[model samples]
Target: MLVYVLAIDIGASSGRHILGTVENGHLALEEIYRFPNGAAMQNGMLCWDREALEGHILAGMKKCKELGKIPASVAVDTWGVDTVLVDHQGTPIFPMAAYRDRRTEQVTDKIDQRRLYALTGIAHQPFNTVYQLMATPADVLERTHRCLFAPDYFHYFLSGVMANEYTIASTSALLCAGKNAWSKEVLCMAGIPEHLFPEKCNMPGHILGDLKKEIADKVGFNCQVILPASHDTGSAYMAVPARDENAVYLSSGTWSLLGIETDTPVTDEAARAYGFTNEGAYGGKVRLLRNIMGLWMLQCVRHELDDRYSFAQMAKMAAESCYPHTVDVGSNRFLAPASMTEEVKAALREENKPLPKGEHDLFRCITQSLAVCYAQAIRDLEKLTKKTFTSLNIVGGGSNNAVLNQWTAKATGLPVYAGPAEGTALGNCIAQLIALGEIPDLPTARQMIRKDFDIQEYLP
Candidate 1:
């Protein structure tokens, strides 16, 4: 009998429900529903529409039922760091603030970045939950009964269960270095109450509970809600089909997270100086990665042009153009820029570099700069981990860009294997499969992925 699993993989810009099945030692996926997701200006702050997202989740489940493919279990994975605070009555007390909101900027400035990194082993990001919580108003904090990360909140919505999943919680900058528990010292330092979080954190693959009766009746199906590394990057890393320990994984999407998997967290001064973060991975591993500003630059550029050109068209133009201008793609100035084109031009002018003349040149500049940044990150990873990685596995939506893949290969001087564009959903499904006994372990799941997906290779 074939068993089905559902993966609700939500990113910063979009969300999709994928129904997956494992048969004949291979995995297959069918996207049941997709919806646009973005932070919108509300009450003078950027926030997520929790109700709309909840409605879409129910609609997707109903669609699955209509297709006669009710999954044996369901899991959700989303971008990390953003969270919502629920009151004693299990009601959200404030709007869900997005990670891009500037409310935490002042708070970050007040905290000691180096000390915070030593405590949490997470790099300093202005949008981290630690900063967000510190910026919360006193009245709001007093009423907040529990603070749940994005995926945890959604899982709570489905099962009425309140618990933080380990992987997502690791991104909070509140979890202690090399530990599965929250850091009381860090919380106290930030003046965040200890009671704001769940009493305990659950590891990935833990079955939280069955779907609530109300939701089951509405969707016409009842299944366990399993935790799948609830952080989207964690799930995406789970889908990397690496053969051995000598492989580096890049979960390329809105953010390009490139790093190696390690059994222990890297919390030394060098790691911190390199801006590397130690996030939890499945089965008690640590993802020692650096977050590079990825396609967001190109995304902003496309948006600035009112999306006059499709991504494919831009990629083709970038491949043909001969622009040599490059800027630090990871700079804070590129984050939530008012105008990406103007920002790039400004940076070029300041550096006394040749300015991009047209759309093609601008696209080329972004792509080439990203590849260079990736190469630098790879060098840093090797130096920190003391491991030479022979291959780079590029997974997620950004892996679909052949032009960028080739440039990455050339820049890094390493062979690149790019495929499984739906890596987050695939990894989410695999976690559900593991919980359902359809797969034995992560290594076996990766082997099955290798058999199922066609990975295109680019040589240096």
Candidate 2:
């Protein structure tokens, strides 16, 4: 009998439920369900619709029942830093703010960046969970009973067990990067109570429990609710089919997280200066990455156009244009802009640079600028880590853009391997397979991915 597993991978813009099983010495994946997701304004703030997402999760599981592929285990992995605050009775408080909300604009200013970096080794981002908690109203914190990262909250809802996963918790800047545990000093700095978090964090592949009786009955089956990295990037990193030890990883999607995994956190001043963050990887490792503004710009521009053009069309248009201008795609001005196209135009105008003449030119500028950003990040990463990366592995949904992959190769002067488009989902499944004893360890899983997936290469 085939042992099936479900990997629910959620990002800022979408989510998918993928069923995976090992068949004839290879992994096979079938997407059971997919759903659109995004933040919406709630009480004057951008917030996730928790109830709607919960409903979608249940609906996806029901799809599995219909297909007669009731998974032996199920796990969820989502974008990190945004968390849910629960009341004493395990009910989530209303209005779980998104990481993009402007409320954290001044929250980081209250703490010393260098000092905090020393404590956590995380980059100073205005939208980090530490800043978000600090910006939260004290009245709300008073009534809160526990703080669970988004994936943890969803896991709790499924298993009726409240717990924190290390990878997701590492994004909060409340965990000591070197120690891989909660930091009382950082929590005190944010004025967040210690009681809000769990004393011990569960690692990836940990089986929380069987799905709650109510959830099992609703979905028409019971399965183990396992933890799979919890943070989407953590899972994405695991799917990188690197040929050697020196390859840099780029988990390209809404955000371009470019970095290499290290056994110890890099917290020196040079690292802090270059804006590298040390998020947790599986097995107590650290992923020292830089979060760059990524396809979100193109995604916004496409949305504004009512999505008339598919991503492929946009890429083709971009490749046809020889736009000479490249804007600083990493600028905060591009973050949550009123109009992405207009914002790019304004940025060019401010720099006395030629503005993009039309849609093709604009699209080319975005892709070229992103390539430039990726190149700079690689340079900085090499400098910080003191190791020259021979290749770049670009994964996740964004890996499908051949134009961007080729340009990334040219910009960074490194061979770019882009494919296995459902990287996050693949990595999510890897954790489940490992826990189920179908795979022995991470290296073995990575080798399996390399053998089974089509990883396209773009040479510089």
Clashes of each: 0, 0
lDDT (10s digit) by residue, model 2, range 1-460: 8899999998899999999989877988999899999999988999998988999999999999999998999999999999999999999875779998999987779998898998899998888999999999898888888999999999999999999999999998999985657999988888998888757788999999999999999999999999999999999999999999999999999999999999999999999999899999998899999999999999999999999999999999999999989999878888899899999999999999998999999999999999999999999999887899999999998999999999999999999999789999999999999999988899998988999999999999
lDDT of candidates 1 onward, in order? 0.92, 0.93
**Candidate 1 runs further than 4 Å off:** none
> How do the predictions measure up, each by TM-score?
0.99, 0.99
Task: Give me candidate 2's TM-score against the actual structure.
Answer: 0.99
The CA lDDT at 29 in model 1 is: 98
Clashing pairs in 2: none
lDDT, candidate 1, residue 358? Answer: 91
